[model samples]
Target: MELQQMRYVLAVAETANFTRAAERCHVVQSALSHQIKRLEHELGAELFARTSRRVRLTPAGEAFLPAARQCLEAADRAAAEAAATVGEVRGRLSVGVIPTVAAVDVPAALRDLRRRHPQVRVALRTGASDDLTAEVANGRLDVAFLGLPSSSRPTGVQSHELARDHLVAVLARDHPLADGGQLDLADLSAEPFVDFPYGSAGRAQTDHAFAHAKLTRDVAFEVTDAALMAQVIRHGLAIGFLPSAYLQRAPELRGLAAITVTNAPSRVEYVVWGSPGPSPATVAFLATIGLQPTPE
Candidate 1:
């Protein structure tokens, strides 16, 4: 019934070990166990099944975990709102990003957010769009900036389009067709290819482009890091197909040329968050990106 007791129960349920749960709660094992026992006595049901090897959540525990997390999140937000009313925003803000992003000036946005909300601590997690999308839905991330398919969208979350950037062919300055100004996938069919890893959001666009042309590229390298891929292209190790904006922004690919690919698909970058309602930090960050504020 007590907020502290609710925290203890959730911790125990999450860790599945009373000792580790107590450690996480910064309390002695006996104190945490006593609180959980008191909670179970009040509910008139066992919340956990303990054995010599492991602890498993009982049916009651499984059902109670979500509500406990919601209560904690609500309490934290109430405290944050109270602080904000006094002209202070004091809370942790966690944002997720994909490996490569061209839709938003993320660094500039973060700089502005930090300037405006000095009390807010921020962290960034990077991954592919699919992985980061799941993180947002599961409440691990407050917002995610990443590339999503122009034709397909994510479920269970709200997404706002930030920008659509074309995927273009990149090659060394002296390479053949480097000065072509405009090219297509078929032009690179016989060339050594470098690209984002297959099945990724960026690679999907490139793959779709090739499939549309009925031509298969001789991809010699698949890289996830844009800087490294640019370096690979600059050395003439392989030709690359990446976001045009990304190549433009990367100083590492200074000697490379980006060819506009006619009929190519653009990687649409979007900002996404959970549907429970946008977090205050997420809304504030979006403002710098010129989005309408997410209402509470």
Candidate 2:
């Protein structure tokens, strides 16, 4: 009859052990048994055949199981919808981002999100683009800011473009190509290169750039953080590609050089939602942050 009763029934059906079910449901075994007895009394039939060794569902219980599940699912959906309607977008929002985006302008976006949706708490995690994409697809994350080279058809999830960022090669100020207005892959091929971890969005871009130009790199180091890579380049260790947005934040790396790559692809950042679409707060947060909704 009640949602809690339905939930209890589902849990009992899963475990088939009163003590285990009660523990999983965070209730006392006696209370669980009493509630099941009450439910059986209301239905005028025993839902479970209890024995010393174990409990098993009865015919009636088998027939009622699907209906009980449906009832609980419907109630949960209705509650979620009602919460959205009331604009009560107040809950934990687990967000994922690639290291480049996390260090880029993504923080500015979060500041705006918090300013608009003060009640929505956020947890930020950063990883490689592939890892973030997989997490979003598998429902480990509620939403994420994923670099676009990693973007593809949203299989089992919904996604929208956040922004387009220009990709540039970061280099040491005194390096030969630094002062040259523009440099191609051929010019930098022999230059010691710092690259993103293989399989990352930035590395994908780097690979593509080299592939397009028929060039190869002598990578000296690989790192996830573009800012740190910039530092590495400053010391003339290796040079790598990063977004222009990264330049705006690193005032300390003043002597570092950034050269816009010609004929190379730019990176697009996306805001992705893990299954069941966005919560009201998330929707509003995206809108507030100016991410255009992707057509369904």
Candidate 3:
């Protein structure tokens, strides 16, 4: 019934261990267990099925979980809104980003936000553009940094474009075509390549480009991490395409050559938020990054 009791229950449900949950909540195990027992008694049902080894949520607990989360979220939003009325931004800002984000310096922007609004709590998550956009639309994330093919735009959310750039070919310094000259997609069609997973936005740009040119390239390796993709290209196993900014930011990848692609595929980076409108914390973050919300 009490907010603190709900916090304890949620922690226990997440960790599935009394002692660990107590540690997470900064309380002793006995105190946490006692509070949970009090809450269960008030609700007229046991929230957890306890065992010597593991703890699992009971059917009653499962039914109560979603409402509990909604209650907590509502309470937090109320407090944050009250704070914002006095020109103070104090709330939890959940942000999602793609691994290859390069339009704005995310860490620098977040650091500035922290300095400007010390009371605001910031959480960062990295994921694919598609998943990140969906999280923003679902209200699970306050903001997201995404990269999509130039032909595509994010739907169901308010977005502002950050930058657009063509991808460059990444190759080992010793590769035959690492001469720094501009090359077309057909030039690399016969060569094995390292690329993002087939269905990912990063891969789609290259795929569409090749298809438009009536060429097909063999993808010898599929990787999700940009650093790993660079390493694979550095090893001479395969060539890959990436935004030029990636090479500029990573010194370790300097040994690899980046050849300009004359007909390279291009992608656009965007900052998106839910259509419900921006929270004060989200607005502050956008300003820190030198962007304003797009009109609905």
Candidate 4:
């Protein structure tokens, strides 16, 4: 029996509706039915019992389902290994990203990844750190750059903490405490603060810092983008904490007064992935960002 036949069988078994299975398998219902019928003939046994309302797996189908899944998985692994060894990686790599979380130079990394693997294509999607982590866990993403807890990652996924930057408080130049040169989490306790949304790395770090000090601030706004949060700080809307790199990299941000928060938590970014065999393009992308195929 062919792999296509086995896939059709599995799809039908899962959906229990030939039409739905056919749609999922990207084939006409008639064609899928033909393949399943042909496979059953080859095996000298009927695999599915079809009725007007539903399809049920026969005893033979139930017995064959696990083996069929294993066969497809093995084929995928063999194909991946062959592609890895042949030469430059030439396939699509789906990458999920979080804003300001991983501290990666994504443009530079992509440029170098393209130079190294010209045939590879990279697809980028931006989301919250938790959302990206979920995508990585479900294998919808080949890899992601996110701010994740060191030990709370999904079971099948691995994450490596590449680097960490200290969090600093950003504020208007005219703010009362801006001239202090340095501050602490408690210093901002009375100020209405702007913060990263829950589940984002920056937000997590800030929360930990406050919790460690047994203090809480009045959060006036929750934003995911550091640039926007900085803008709010610049307008004197509220104080906010940003990775020191953000303060250093953006020229416009330099106009604002930024102070180191001695008691604030440091935010670490991670490069994370699911399973083991990533495409050549993904491996190249990782290397461009000062990483290796192995996960921590």
Can you write out model 2's per-residue Cα lDDT over 45-97, one digit (the tens) per residue? 99999999998999999999998886775565466557777676555567887
Worst ten in a row by lDDT for model 1: 287-296
As for candidate 4, its clashing pairs are none
- List the global CA lDDT of all models: 0.81, 0.74, 0.91, 0.79
- Sequence-dependent TM-score of model 2: 0.67
TM-scores, each model vs. reference: 0.73, 0.67, 0.95, 0.69
> CA shift at 31, candidate 4, in angstroms?
18
* Alpha-carbon RMSD, candidate 3: 1.6
lDDT of 2 at 204: 79
Candidate 3 residue-wise lDDT, 175-194, digit = tens: 99999499989899999999
Query: Per-residue lDDT of 170-284 in model 1, one digit per residue for the tens?
Result: 8889898898777766777889988777787767877777787898877799887888888888888998877777766777778788788787767788898777766666667
Model 2 poorest ten-residue lDDT run: 148-157
Q: Rank the candidates by lDDT, best first.
A: 3, 1, 4, 2
RMSD of every prediction: 4.4, 7.8, 1.6, 6.5
Candidate 3 local distance difference test against the native: 0.91
- Against the true structure, candidate 4 has what lDDT? 0.79
TM-score of 1: 0.73
